[model samples]
Target: MRKSSSLINIKEVLLSTRKVLNENAIIDSDLESDLLVAFALKITRAQLHANINSPISISEQKTIQNLVNRRIGHEPLAYILGVREFFGNLFRVNESVLIPRQETECLVESIINYLRHKSIESPKVLDVGCGSGVIGASILKYFPNIDLISIDISPNAAQIAYENILKITNNNNFHVLVGDLIESIKVQVDLIVANLPYIPTKRIPTLQKEIFLYEPKTALDGGTKGVEIISRLIEQSTKILKPDGAIFLEIDPDQKYILKNKIQHLFPKHKIKVLHDLSGQERVLSITIL
Candidate 1:
């Protein structure tokens, strides 16, 4: 697309981008426009504003337009930007892994809070289905001394998670392995945390376009009943978790009762607590083996 004027500046480009995004019904068009423009220019949003009046090259404008087109085509903003912030830290992201969501932060918080009170030093943590390594990496950022093992079924996803964990924590206390759940795990751990795929297979198509169309299907589908993978994980936790160990999982609110029952059956002498996100939705499940 050709620019309306020969000397198009950053301000004009941002306005035109926002207008196009708004026309396409994209939410937060203003912020998205700023982010896209800044990303295209390899600059920060603050720098974009400071140089709003500066002229933009034709090549630069074309780059911004390309990104805007991708967004309008239903690609997620995080994928387009190649990064996402979680628990106050930014992690690299791509199509190989699921995009980090704010609600998952609740799981990280609960783990940190539990560890803070527990006397276990250098606790071993097992992160099941570690997409992009956000959960384990976030916890390690706060507790650098802890040993963490992150496992993912997809080799591509595992590689991305490995890179993200190393880049974010810069600590050698974690291992990212490619495996399905905890089947390959032999070492007992003090905690098992997972944000596994929980959306039922039938419900996958009903998700937003950015999710269903672009996000990895393996990262979203949770088998037929939606709790199949989680139930398996809970059952597997029985053999791998150490005594007085705990398990924290991010789950769909609707799956809590079913999962709770499964956990109760498998871990009869356990304490289970459901945590609510800011929106009051039951998001995380904490299971303490007593």
Candidate 2:
């Protein structure tokens, strides 16, 4: 974004942003440019299109320039804008929590489908590492009678999840616990869904800078083999879940066997199934107690 432009309109601002970002090899430069412009105008995407030629005030241009500079420095666009949409709802996000990914939505979908198919009325649900509260919150929004307890080890993540849960639904049946895995809970649940930290410790450095540098390590690192936190969650869930309860987890594509083996070794009677996202990549782990 050139600061020396005399008079700028929304169209010119977006075009300039796209050019600068594309030049720097930024992915999705066009979408990022549109979102930044919409954020600056405080308007919806539809409104942005209707007023594409509207003039941007001098103050607004300067503000957008600052955001552009931040993005140019490899900062996440979600962090720069202060929000990200997940499962069709906007979630407040910062450096404290991982930005909700589209693939994780498969975890939510699998849980919903299981609950409905089994006709599990008043299902007690536990969301482990519930960053932004998107997973559990989406469930509660659809099933108001469902009991949900969402837990995260990070205080900032817990706070953001709490706020998102409240704003997303009026259901008071959900609880946000700030703790590691299921250590903070005593009661058994009908289902458990986790999007835990499963990235290998050594591979964290190999991830995109936006993830390794910007996101919290506690919410990303999975210890030596990338199953430390996930292993703990499965072990604890076996004790706190009903005999016929189920657990769903989001994981890296390569983690399918390692995670399943852990579950089998810990809970030999449990049944496990791997699910793939729309792109046909192995993404979620579904475990049902026998």
Candidate number of the best lDDT: 1
Backbone clashes, each candidate: 0, 0
lDDT of each: 0.93, 0.88
Write one digit per residue (lDDT tens) for candidate 1, span 1-290: 44456669999999999999999999999999999999999999999999888889889978999999999999999999999999988999999999999999888999999999999878999999998999999999899999999999999889988998998899999998999899999998999999999999999999999999999999999999899999999988899899899999999999999998898888889999999987899999999999
Clashes by residue pair, model 2: none
- Candidate 2's residue-wise lDDT over 1-290, tens digit each? 44345767888889999999998789899899989888888998789889887788899999889888888888999999899998999889999889999998898899888888877768889998998999988989988889899999888899999999999986778889899788979998999899988888998999998887798988888999888889888888868899889989998889888888888888778888889997889999999989
Off by over 4 Å in 2: 1-5
Estimated TM-score for each candidate: 0.97, 0.94
Off by over 4 Å in 1: 1-5
Best by TM-score: 1
